[model samples]
Target: MIGKRYTVPVITLAATRRDVYGKALAKSRTEGLLPVVVYGRKEQSASYFVALPDFKKVYREAGESSVISLKTPEGALDVLIHETGKDPITGEFIHADFYAVEKGKALRVSAPIVWVGEAPAIKLGGIVVKVLHELEVEAFPQDLPHEISVDLAGLETLESQISVKDLAIPAQVKIIAEPDDIVAAVAVAKEEEEAPVMDISQIEVEKRGKQEEEGAGTPEQGDQTSSP
Candidate 1:
């Protein structure tokens, strides 16, 4: 089910953004609860929380990178991620930030950027500089795409700069970004130094040697390494 694409409903949040809390979110989600805040549609602003399992289903269906529908008990709406918080101690979910979406209206979303072809510069010992990891696009919900990829197989020199206009975008999808936006390019490689790996035995040998030099007895050594 995870491998295949699916569309899951993200229910509108009932409480206002200020009303949401950390502990409440974790408990609600763990007990088959879903929590989200939806505010948009030009004054149709209200937050509603959904079931956790249902929300997980949506995340499973849509790559977290893509937008999904938020079907509310009151009405259905479109929304996307703003942020998701994690627990400090246990590293569990603390909260999620959501923004409402309106179809046919321009919306800004962060979509992934990909590389299409093998880099010619890599073969030439040149470094590839990926300046932008993601792009903020202005388009409708349906128009919003999965990802944008740039080819590097033809790039061999640092003089070339690949722009957004060079991307082979779909006819239905119009990139709201500038055509000259450089997604990635090749650069000259810098010399690097290698560091030695400190093995357990080597570390113990060094420690024992230091201890003896300082008039301390050597450890009865058989490789002092601890197993997890």
Candidate 2:
């Protein structure tokens, strides 16, 4: 995560029915915002709200691998987005789930895959293949890693393969994944030619989006995660 952090101030709002929540939620989402409820280990009810754009900025800073500070009127608390809702048409953010955290606690998060170095196979006109774009790991929120990088220049042929066991890790990071997991590998080289255009009779526009994913609850893990 190479971006600056953003602090969002949340206000308490009670929407008893879906009708009320819908109207408030719609208005919040329309202004690039969302409603969130924070329930932690203490079972505290911190029903709050936040702006989508503000959440995005901090989420980017934490790189999705670590926890961030959630600033509220009461005080500042560490947190991570457990879930978020996005607009279907504009593909913008709406509401998000904020999970409480502490730096001293152990947590698990996924790290993004980073391809480093130009492979000899790539320069040899081989098609570079990317696999295992993200990985799940457990660690302290403060110790969460931004990404895991694998150097491809060492690969001499298509037979070369890099597995999760071969991944380089910092001393502070512990490996908790299976060693046999394939991180990336080189495929046989392919040749590329100029663009070939064809007449299109049918075109279907599809929205690119993702569903909110929860952590299935935090467990003791020691793996790295991705960039913001």
Candidate 3:
């Protein structure tokens, strides 16, 4: 999925129906368009294409979790950016999948965790360790948050920690992650060990010894003899 929360107004993207079996996919890309599919719980799947630049702008704001309106020839459909495929080499979005949101139905998604504030433990020579980066939650499309904020100020000591239960989530949302799971913690920083120094004199002696051994195995130029 590609969106965050519905903090901003719903974005409207113009879409045109596409031929799924046609050879125009590559041609569409060259024309600055992105191929996409829209499907819903009860709605039949349909293929379409939207302007690449417009889709990129929407993706930046909506991500995979936010709802956006797709204006097609048939009608306008509210959908979420369910998934996307990118070119491995160029990193360009090759295709996208939009999941239509059913009215009054709840959606399950992983909301990103954004760390805010500074941990006091850092002043005490302790480092902060984050365990989880996202939280699994269920909420209506309109109620889904773009991101959940985690306050690092709670970590005052090396032993102090934050868990999923400590998050400040909306009343309309239900957390699916374990309540006891650690989200972030502080730990005492470990000192790096110094690397041992080597003796240059010993290396020179070993090299000389190897040279002598090789020299002893070969016959001198003046000592060459022919066999009968």
Best by lDDT: 3
lDDT of candidates 1 onward, in order: 0.62, 0.64, 0.86
For every model shown, what is its TM-score relative to the native structure?
A: 0.61, 0.66, 0.76
Q: How many backbone clashes does candidate 1 have?
A: 12
What value of lDDT does candidate 3 attain over all alpha carbons? 0.86
Better of 1 and 3 by TM-score: 3
Evaluate residue 214 in candidate 3 and report its C-alpha lDDT on the 0 to 100 scale. Answer: 98
**For candidate 2, lDDT tens digit of each residue in 1-228?**
122233324322222112236666666556654677775785476666666566667666556666666666677777766776776997766666667776587878888877888878766556667778888877666656767777887676767777777777655565567888777777874467879775453322121111112333446588889789
List RMSD in Å for every model shown: 15.8, 27.4, 7.5
Tens digit of per-residue lDDT, candidate 3, span 34-110 = 99999988889999989999999999877876678899999999899999999999999999999999879988988
What is the Cα-based TM-score of model 2? 0.66
How many Å off is the CA of 81 in candidate 2?
Answer: 1.4
